[model samples]
Target: MPSGLPSALYGWPGLCCIPLKRKNTDRCPASLASLIINHHEDSKAPQLALVASILGLAASLDWKAASNLNPFEKCMEDPDYEQLLKVVTLGLNRTLQPQKVIIVGAGIAGLTAAKVLSDAGHKVTILEADNRVGGRIFTFRDGKTGWIGELGAMRMPSSHRILHKLCRSLGLNLTQFMQYDENTWTEVNEVKLRNYVVEKMPEKLGYDLSHRERGHSPEDIYQMALNKAVKDLRTLGCKKAMKKFNRHTLLEYLLGEGNLTRPAVQLLGDVMSKEGFFYLSFAEALRAHSCLSDRLRYSRIVGGWDLLPRALLSSLSGPVLLNAPVVAITQGIHDVRVHISTSLQSRSLKVLTGDLVLVTASGPALQRITFSPPLTRRRQEALRALHYVAASKVFLSFRRPFWLEEHIEGGHSNTDRPARLIFYPAPDEGALLLASYTWSDAAAPFAGLSTDQALRVALKDVAALHGPVVFRLWDGTGVVKRWAEDPHSQGGFVVQPPSLGHGDEDYDWSFPYGRIYFAGEHTAHPHGWVETAVKSALRAAVKINKHWSRVPSPEKQAILHRLEHIHVSEDVQQQEESPEGHVFVEAIPQVQEHITVETITPGKGHVHVHHQNIPSHVHEKVFPDVHGHVHEKVFPEVHGHVHEKVFPEVHGHVHEKVFPEGHGHRHMHEKVFPEGHGHGHVHETVIPEGHGPLHPGGHRQMEPGSQRHRHMHSSCKGGGGT
Candidate 1:
């Protein structure tokens, strides 16, 4: 009846089954029913419908002729499906050759490099400065209230597939991070307003400012201006756009070429800068927006964002030494020696030598280490060319939800006050509040402030926001996070400036030195994102594997092919398609139960599945199991021969032997029509008035290993309703 199955099918974790929408329709193996039923544990009605629909499609394409042929086995015999199984099995069950590899820093980049190399049969060692693993993915929780504060990287966009893969491999679940919405609050120069009003207020504010704004909504103006600017520079693509915008700041762009009235600029500046708009490289900002502005539904780990890095660390076969910060690095033609020592015994150093090394630390942490023979001029310049900004977050736990009195939902409130913005936790998730989060230069003034002083400042601003009447309702119990103030990380993460040639003397400057490599966000193309960090790490591993690797398997070859071109193009992340991953193999169940089919009757177009439409010609076939139990299957008569088999009792799921190739062919080439425009990305939400603080960790905090950028990561899908 419906064109396809419900959206709930895709939401089911670990399944890559495609939806059969109106446009771009295609048929898959008819045996997907038996395959999914066998691999998938639960036999819900939707799954059965999915199976029946697939079979219906096959039947539409002449199912009777091939019904006995077993499309599942043929689909399994497909070469691509075989290749996928090879890699997935390798990814899950490979043993390395135990070559000594040293990874400096326990950040995502370093850990990723370690995981890839170790999985390929190498001995890996990770050295981290802090006692804990996740360098910037730190989660601050109030011991008493169980409130979670993502002080560093918080939300991830759907386009960030690499990070998503790591999360899935680590067995993590993602929940949407609804930061902005129509029910948000915004404070401009002490005038408090709701987001819903701001989104609809283009007409009331001005005759001078009202030159046919897009939707006459405040968000419309901002979005239109942004879209226009992005469209203008997008021709140059993301890379060149990065160079063009890198020369100017957001303030310059909005006034000079962005073309906004002074009043409009001021209005947007108050809100945008709080989201880390000022002084940030315009190209980086625009790049972040251009690539990810579409798919707007942002999400983070269910339990805690910190759990992802922890899972990564646990996936490693080697030792992850904590508090063992790498103090110095020495490189030779054949080997690398990394000098590491704990903070308690800084002077007592232990040297661990490896055939190859990957340095995932730099900026503040890099400056702390001594490099023998010195880093190349270009590398040193690249390091110096990188900019780091102070970012501070004050987490406030209140006795009660005061904003509810104002009919304000739990989101972020934008303000021009010193506090910048305040974010409330999700609904019924308790009353822990991210009282104040300031970025870049805005964070400077509050960086050294005491927790009480920061709380007072946040309260004053909150009072200024919701009203001074509510100051007494808040009980001050919270902690402040000033990442720049930390000794390990000088200032949040690195932001790229214009004309930065991130070259090194190592491996054509990209893979770094023959014995040593650089893998961090700053070292990668898209700055300030863990995605960039992970990409850099994998890139380094690819180079290392190329230099010294064991005998290659087909699975390893596929993985190599994947890692070789992980990032799209140097210019933009768009206009190019990513290589598809294990399309159907992993999504299907590996273990299939023994199958038994009974009497067959091909239902007519008007017949329900249980109703027998085609006359059944009963003929029975018996098979004996290991338990000596006989299974008799009855089928319809076709030209005096048994016509076809019917799928009958096999408990709640499918059995393997009935359709041997069930596990391999899981995906069908079908376009999905979500409630929005389609992309390989996620949904978009209304951000005009939503109030989630930046949990940015740019290609992470613009620096890979530590820190997040000032904005939340999002993907594009063409949804304008938000």
Candidate 2:
């Protein structure tokens, strides 16, 4: 019967016929059917190919019947595979032109982008605000006992193939992260019951549930609520159905389309630890639900999740600069310039010019950095308004495996208390328990408290769940991590609140602008997952590779090359001190560029001026005395417009001034330059034509209208060089 089909499609002769659903008989065959054929032990059989051929033949016959039996169609229904395919392509592709790419923030997204781009021959440099690598992938390990706890992200769903594949490629070991166990406890409405028995009786738990929802578990009933929405998603497609039903919040969905009693919905929220998240968009909730359903198991790295980032760091061919926070980014006609504040004693501001710039900072961190020319109004509004949920975790180490004695190897206890969830890792996890895992409203209070105060609050909640004996078992060591309190990560993860609506366009702020690009989990669909971060990284890298040929011109490259050679010496002698021990040093740039000035007002004052674009044979040095005064002669051969600026009396303030040049004149200055003070004075000059070659008589060479050149001043005590 199947002789015309490819002979390579070998499978079991057994076949089950399925009746097609017919809506019309005009072009229908009397014997319309679908076949489910069993395959043999041969794994390479062309099963799907044969099925597609049969479907094609049926379509050629003008059959009016509909069939959803195509395995390819079922799998491709969602964009998950398409996204993963892009990630895999990025991971496998290694041929590309080498370009200078500067990635802001050394988080997972930044690291992944750097890894892929660097492997493809790009010279990538990662600038991290904090001293650590992993942004939200932090891990806390006890130094003495070797116990470990995840302060940020903990679990990895088995369905996250990209993350799993990355872990394997990085040679990291993985273990089952027992997300739930039958012996786990659920406490709600002052009543506690094991998870296995919670579904048996709802009335005893004070929940007035419906007849159909009575015997179903909270997870089951949640699926039941999504049944109609899922049907709409299947029939009307994701975009149309989401547009139709996503206007409702999770709370609204449960009350309206879910058709469940209020008590039942409330019970579901309590048992599922989603009380704080009910206000989020139902569409966002559904996306999260698809990733976290019971059908997909979870896993975690063996030692700690930080190993992944560390491995990525080790794999990079470029450097990762720690404690270097990027303060500003400017997009030029040819390249992008990133300004970073160094952690050195000089507190010097460094400018890194690259072919492409990828910003992987979190939403809050991105808000802090200044952008030249300004971002689009929509992107700025999205950055200002998009919501990031608060999350806090309290980890406690126990001297003994107390929960194991109760035959509970791993799982979590859901409760209506301040600690919405308590997770117990497996025995091999060194008895370190996530005593408190709270999100959104539940985490707000914890984020404001000190570690000791947070520990006390968490202990109180744990005692309520496990009785007073838990205090005795606690090993006197606890770690509290409030993601909102973290300077790098202002909040835990991003979520589209109901107020923001359910459209994915709200998060499109990460889209590329000019030569600058954006990445991070917040910028992608299914926010707050490591997989999302990886996918976003892949996307940014692919875009960069596609648009990488827009390299800077030869003149721009020369200026950028010269900028890298400009170095500031850290040697400065201390002079007379002020009564309050205030020291201030200001910087003036040679070219019309953006300069970020940082001041360190300690006790004394000294000034050292760095002369850039000078011949290798000649150098100019300027030194200021205790009176904060310097005498210098301006270059006589200067042919450019001279714009003099005076600085006000800066006692203890740090100021940044941007002198953007339109043609050859400074039409506008971002900040106010105070009138010249006789005590400490700084002047500004913009060289229109290129500076001529430098000689021993204090002349230097520089590009015309170059934004990459800057002249820095530091306090030095001596005299001037010839």
Candidate 3:
């Protein structure tokens, strides 16, 4: 049987078949069917082989898909392989190199830059000279009361867009700091002033000036004046306003130009000096008012403002080396290296090579760092020209809220003059925190005092305000972090000197060699403010991103894409237009006119005529137009009586009437009242019957009792006769 098989079955030597048989006679044809089935199965082998080969190919492709990685990791594992692969695949990695970005100072600006660069696929390293990340935002826990004391930058305004956004993203909690009511207080001059309810004082003064403004009770007029003044100031740029106001001190501006009285000047000066540093000039004060005009609505931050830096730091993927002080910077055309000292014992100096270096240190710290190729003359001059104001901030936490009880009356207490004391009544954990600041010359006296001495002086000042009550002084627990002594931050913040020159005027203060970029609150727009820090950082980041041509990460790219697509809707556009062109004017209504003329001749040979037009349903209310009356009274009384009459013509209509009943009569009434119910009667009766006619015409000549009757009737008819 095997020999009889077809030649096509020669390759299938192992082929086998089984036949089904119904009885032995029916199974006779089964053998033949089995042979035919074997031939058909043999013919289908090639097709099955093709199908198996296709499935094997698909499995190999799926394995490759599962093992694929991002370009970053691929490059890290095999740099040479990645370069070769890019050359063959996309032809892009020939000149591709990792970017390094060094950020000096681990404050908010530094952290922000680090996060931005890191997210942009750049290698970032942060060098913070201080032991901690927060530079100016120092939070200390009181040993006794266990309350937190913010010795550095504390309150953040609600308008701080970046800070507020960061806080919300971080899920931090912010608590409001409650201020005590102002009651009894003494001024810096030692004058005792009783506190009056601020809400009631304006009503009492009959002027309505808000707390922000000082003036009369009807606040509308004062507000209008302020709005106009603000509009005018805005029309003139801030720099121009500063320059315009710079020549005069606040005192001089208030008294000479602002037209403020001595008392008003003193009150405003005291408030401004206490709130800001005393070093702030009148021009600086105006600039501050302009800058903070938008931020005057809210003051707070959840979990303290320090959370801002912390949140920024958390977003940074790079290493932040705290206590690592950058002593020098060496720059090349393509690479900048920074020398940082980590510790005294190790003396380990790490060289950080970066394509860009951001120096976020204070103005004073920048002055101290040595540059390899010395900073340009222009940059050096800028550093020298910029001056940091010396400010000392002291925070005191008490066991109980004593100041709140004492100053809780109506207005802010005036006890601590020069030093404004804001009592936090129901503080976190029922603790009281007092923050005091002095600037320029006034700050010198406090510099020599220790933490304990400063606390004693501040407590004593508070005691004096509240009448010598016992202070729960934190002796060992008192913490003082003076910015003056801080190495990284040599002073509080930058203050433009009166001699610092004008707006956008190029200052020699460019970063050393232009390779190192300086940014912080001081470098921010409009000078020192928390918002400036974030804004300055963003500006610097934009410059760096532009230089690198780096594609931001997926998350950041999505954000940028979404922002670019955003546009203002038409509804908002329409609302922004001025309404002046849309305003309509209505025509005045017309009424019938009645005119009356009368002549008077007095017995003393004095003749005068008076005229008035009285309208129905309306009566003339007499008020001495004092301004016009003054000018009329300037002339001497002619013939013992200055005869002056007001004849105001309305729309070219003249109604003239004689006084003293149209006869030569002397009227002795001080005033006259029109005939009406509940009206004020004139002091004297109209020209008496016996008196001569006001005019030359006698009553009898006009008519009999009819002449006098007609005269009386006409007089009464003219004035809605009683």
Q: Return the top candidate by lDDT.
A: 2
Between prediction 2 and prediction 3, the one with superior lDDT is: 2
Clashes of each: 39, 7, 29
Give per-residue CA lDDT, model 1, range 479-591, as digits (tens): 78888877666677666434433321112235354356777877754566666677677767766665556545454334334322221111112222123311110001112
Listed in order, each prediction's TM-score against the native is: 0.61, 0.69, 0.55
| Shift in Å, residue 228, candidate 1 | 6.0
Cα lDDT tens digits for candidate 2, 1-722? 35543211111110012112222211111111112222323443687456545745644431112114222123223355465555654553554445678889888999899888877767677778886789999999899889889998888875577888888888999988777666778888899887656744555677888788776666556656766775676788756666655567888998888777888888877877657768888777766665553323578999999999988887875656666677777544345667666544533445566767889998888887765434554567777876888899998878887888767777788888777889988877677889999888878768668788888888888888888789998878799988887888888998886545335434554457655788998887777799889888888887676555343445434544543232111112432223432222232222222222322111111112233331111111111212443231111112233232111122421222333223322322322112222312222111111121111111112222222323332111111100
Write the number of the candidate with greater lDDT, choosing between 1 and 3: 1
Instruction: List model 3 lDDT by residue over 1-722, tens digit each.
Output: 13443221111100111111121211111223234344457887665455334323422333123223111111112113333222222222211223557788877777766666556555566777776777787766655555665667665544344555545555667654332222544345554443323212322322233454442211112122233323435577545654655554554555555554454444443432423432455555544543332112234565466766776676665556666577666543334657554344432333455656888888777766655334544455667866676667666665566654554422234333434543343423444355355655446657878888886776666665656443544332345556777777877777654544445353522222334676787764445566566556655665565544443445433433332221111121122212221111111111121223221111111122233222111111111121342122111112122232222322332221212222312121211122224332212111112111121221110001111111121111110000
The segments of candidate 1 whose C-alpha lies over 4 angstroms from its true place after superposition are 1-97, 202-210, 226-242, 290-295, 344-347, 405-407, 468-470, 500-509, 550-722
- Per-model C-alpha lDDT, please? 0.52, 0.61, 0.44
Candidate 1: residue 678 Cα off by (Å) = 72
TM-score of 2: 0.69
* Cα error of candidate 3 at position 610, Å: 99
- By TM-score, the best candidate is 2
